[model samples]
Target chain A: AQSVTQLDSQVPVFEEAPVELRCNYSSSVSVYLFWYVQYPNQGLQLLLKYLSGSTLVKGINGFEAEFNKSQTSFHLRKPSVHISDTAEYFCAVSPRGSNYKLTFGKGTLLTVNP
Target chain B: NAGVTQTPKFRILKIGQSMTLQCAQDMNHNYMYWYRQDPGMGLKLIYYSVGAGITDKGEVPNGYNVSRSTTEDFPLRLELAAPSQTSVYFCASSYSLDPDREDTDTQYFGPGTRLTVL
Candidate 1:
């Protein structure tokens, strides 16, 4: 079994400042990690995913996340925040192979202020 | 392509009512899933279909049913709606993850159905 935990429920940051969204997971086996963003009244969009290989992965909207196996964390970071970047971010995990169970965290509401 | 589409963008059902939320995808994916999102509750998996004619329960499958007759459609049925069931529902689809084939576990979501049960 696998589960996800997003550290923050809400994070407020100013535009042009850096921001980070922390996520951690618990599983007895290897799993895939993903970050999704949802705008107001919209569907969740894939921000990025960590299948394998690189520990540091980059996604759209100038977002990046690093997979730290030791800490069991996949934290999302943006170099410079934008007002448009304000949205709900979700961290998810699913076991390897054909297992289709994708567990998601409670989500973090990132509010970017001007 | 219309990755995933869910009909009846918004709906309100009374207690003991029944309804069906339609979901369709054009990606020809072998996997389809239903999820419900509540305020500050993230998302709870309702049901999932591995392929046509194969369906299974997820974390929260109570009060709901699903069938996958075709590769493009997977509709969710609410037998007896309750106020506890009021939430936004989202349908997602993804390609099959084969051991030999490339890994594609990314799930594409629909616009979601805002369900309100009184």
Candidate 2:
């Protein structure tokens, strides 16, 4: 079984400030990592994913994540956040050699304050 | 394409009531899923179907039932609704199961239906 842990329950940042949301995972085998963003009262939208290849992956709305294999982490980063970036972010992991059944972290609410 | 679509944007149910959450996809996706999101918690899979006539329980499937009568439709049924079942439900679909097909596994989600049981 796989599980995800988001280090922070909430992150408040000022507009134009850089931000990072930490995520860690535990799994017996290799896994695929994903970041999803959910706006208020809406379903989740895929922000980015790390299946293979480069450790640094860029996503929509100027969001990016670095997959650290040694640390078992996939932390999301944005150089400059905006008010529109306020949302809940979730990290998910799926088994390496199976159907895509995701195990998600609790989530971290990103509040971009002016 | 309309992608994945779920009906009933919001609903309220009394204890012991029953209801079905309808889901349909126009993307010809073979894999459909039902997930519920609670406050502060991420989505938990309730049920899933790999194709028509094939349904399976997910991580949190208790008090829930599902049917995949057609490739385009997958409905989730709630029997004897409880307050614990009140949450936002989302329907998602993916094209295939191949791990190498990561692009295809990127699920498309619906608008979601918020249910409150009192």
TM-score of each: 0.97, 0.96
| Span of 10 residues, lowest total lDDT, candidate 1 chain A | A93-102
- The runs of at least 3 residues in candidate 2 whose Cα sits more than 4 Å from the true structure, single-residue gaps closed, are A97-99, B97-102
Supply the DockQ value of model 1: 0.72
Writing each residue's lDDT as its tens digit, candidate 2 over B1-118 gives 9888899999999999999999999988898999998887788999999999999999899999999999999999999999999999999988765655555666778999999999
Highest DockQ scorer = 1
lDDT per residue as tens, model 1, B1-118? 8779999999999999999999999987899999999989899999999999999999999999999999999999999899999999999998865544443777889999999999
- DockQ (Cα-based) for each candidate: 0.72, 0.65
lDDT of 1 by residue, A34-89 (tens): 99999999999999988888999999999999999999999999989999999999
Report the Cα lDDT for residue B35, model 2: 94
